[model samples]
Target: MFAMLVRLYLTVAGLLLCSMLLVQQAFPYLFPDQYSQSARHEFSGELALLREHLRGVGIGELPERIAALNRSNPDRYSVLSPAMALRLPARVLAELAASGTASDHVSTEHHHVYVRLDHGDVVQISYDESDFPIRYIAYATVFAMVLVGLMIWLQPHWRDLERLRDAAARFGDGDLNARARLPGGSSIRQLCVYFNNMADQIGCLIQSQRDMVNAASHELRTPITRLEFGLANLGDTLDDRVARARVHALRCDVEELDLLVGELLTLGMLERSGPMPALERIDLSAFLRASTGVSAEELRIRSTHIEWELAPALKEVVVEPRSLGRAFSNLMRNALRYADGTIRVGAEAVEHGWQLVVEDDGVGIPPEDRLRVFEPFYRLDRSRDRATGGFGLGLSIVRQVIDRHGGEIHIESSPLGGARFVMRIPWHQPGEWRGRSRAPREEPAADAGHFEHSFHLQ
Candidate 1:
């Protein structure tokens, strides 16, 4: 707001100054007679007194008299020969001869006057301009007035713009109901109205989309259940082995569809505007252990090794266990799908918060695709198959959960030679617990197999 005001003030001041200068330059040319009259009127009294004094002095004594006047006055005085005076412009010389006094403005600041004495001598006077400070003060006063007026004019507009900007920001951040409310007399009231209307349309559109997804997911469950039941009964009745296998495959496809519907429902619910989940204080180490244990048991047949590196200083931290656990479980399952042999999970106390890291020693995601991986239904080119990638909603759900908890997540190249998922949860003040230890700790060993069990750094 201040910047806007400054810019406006400077622009107005510059244009005003330029216009004044332009008029000053053009006025003399556009109205020569009027300019001459004004200048002559301004110096008329001084010229009259000097002319009278010169008239009393003899022609030969005029130099000494004018020199005396020069010493006593700021205006320079001199005596000129009639022939020398004739060197002036014809019109000015004519005016001087006719009026006995004539003036010429040599510049905006300097003026010249000529007077004919009775002795046929010409007295030339030059003004030494010294009103610069006063002129500058006047210009400064004008600029100051302009600044004040600009502030008064811009204040309400700036306030209205700030309100509009904040409303747009909140709307972008998923506050679908956020709208700009401006006073009726606001200069940008029309803009605010348009913004509010846009917000309303967008809010309705998003609400409709969520409602449709939610309703559709619910509607799909009944048909999916019937398909599953029919497939199971058909598989039991089949006598041929190939037919049984085909029936089993059909059941698997129906289960996959059911899983997709369930994920859609979860994503839809997460997308809804509501209060955050209730937080609970839980032991960080135990939470990590339990979240990883379930995934480890499910993937035990793959012979994948799981390692935990929990900081000893990390004791109790507050979090919404259900949502956070879902996020962690999704990350673990994602790592399980891609990991070659080892998966590493770590939790450590960080300044003002805690950090959770999940890494797998598999093919790392491309740097270009890291951010897009968190978009719903967005999968890497290599993970397009059902066997390699689920419905591509896992990372999106994780991001939503982290956002709800006022945390953030990012992907990096893991030291374990694959993709790393890092989640940082800021300290929740409701059930805040600060670690007693603040000692410096070293980085965990890069090799996950080096730690057979959870390694706690004290």
Candidate 2:
């Protein structure tokens, strides 16, 4: 801080001195009369006051008395024109010649005072430049004060800049969360906010990548271990039936491994940074029924029921159909695992876009676990047992796909006494959508009721 102040002081002082020197060098020729006339006006009052004081002394023997005064004070006082050979400017000579009064005053280029006396001679008073270095000192002092004030104003800016530099340095050194905190009212607050935002996004991205790598490594172990155990058993087994069962178990393990890898790849694609996928305008009702129809049949074998009926007005929605279908499939499969007898699914237009709801009438998630249930490899207590639950990658896939669609998913207590997962997804093209009628969709053939349309709207 001291070094900065010193530098500013020197720089500002140098420029001020140079500028003053330039004005002094050019003033006589460029603005000759302006400065000279003002200077004369200023000292004119002093000259008149002195003349008044000397009025009592009388001017009868002015020339003789001036010579005596000059002899007495060689430096401070001088008598001019009549006796001393002091050179005067032509303008001053003309003014003196034309004046009706005796005490006419004029200013000189060398910065002297001239006063014409009644005795037809002029009195000159020349000031030595050395005696008043205080004037130049006054200018420097004012410049110093101004420079100090400027430094005070700039101190906060410099401090903020230094803080930002340190934050960037720490980030470069692998501190992912390093961020600059500046005062709210500071001049560079907007810049600091943008920097902090960028840092946060970078940190989130890296953390997500880390989570993916760790979870993939951990989850791949079960199937690989099973395959190894199956290989160990294959050569030693004697019974044909036992061998067939072992082969079936091996095939299932291989299929599970393939499914896990496929899901992982899909999740990675969703999380990766890229341009948005091209959208297709599709009938939302037909798409929903077709996608859920397969899931409903699969669940029927396990005696699981899914109640899905798309609203008629929700027909045309712009979206990446394949990816969105995968997300919906995830929700369907997830609901089936926990649903006791019935699963409810539907879509409705909301203020911004569409809200797809999946609810089950089974065990609802605990309040504490609701937030983290969407994370990869996050399994509920029931789900930890493979007999009842999956590998825990299903909801994670749903979340990634939903996030890629620029939407959010939230969980709440269902009206059906189970967990309700609301995937609030916005339309791909916001400009094309407005309010549309919520007419009913074509009814599916009822086989003593497949599933219920569970929306409680009267």
| CA lDDT of every candidate | 0.79, 0.67
User: Cα lDDT of model 1 overall?
Assistant: 0.79
Stretches of model 1 off by over 4 angstroms after superposition: 48-57, 61-76, 229-247, 293-296, 381-386, 431-458
**What 10-residue stretch in candidate 2 is worst by lDDT?**
100-109
Q: What tens-digit string does per-residue lDDT give for candidate 2 at 198-225?
A: 9999889887886776578567867677
Which pairs clash in the backbone of model 2?
Answer: none
Cα lDDT tens digits, model 1, 168-285, are 8778767788888898999899998988888889899999989999999999999999999999999999899999999998998899899899889888877876766566889888
Best by TM-score: 1
TM-scores, all candidates, are 0.85, 0.49
CA lDDT, candidate 2, residue 398: 80
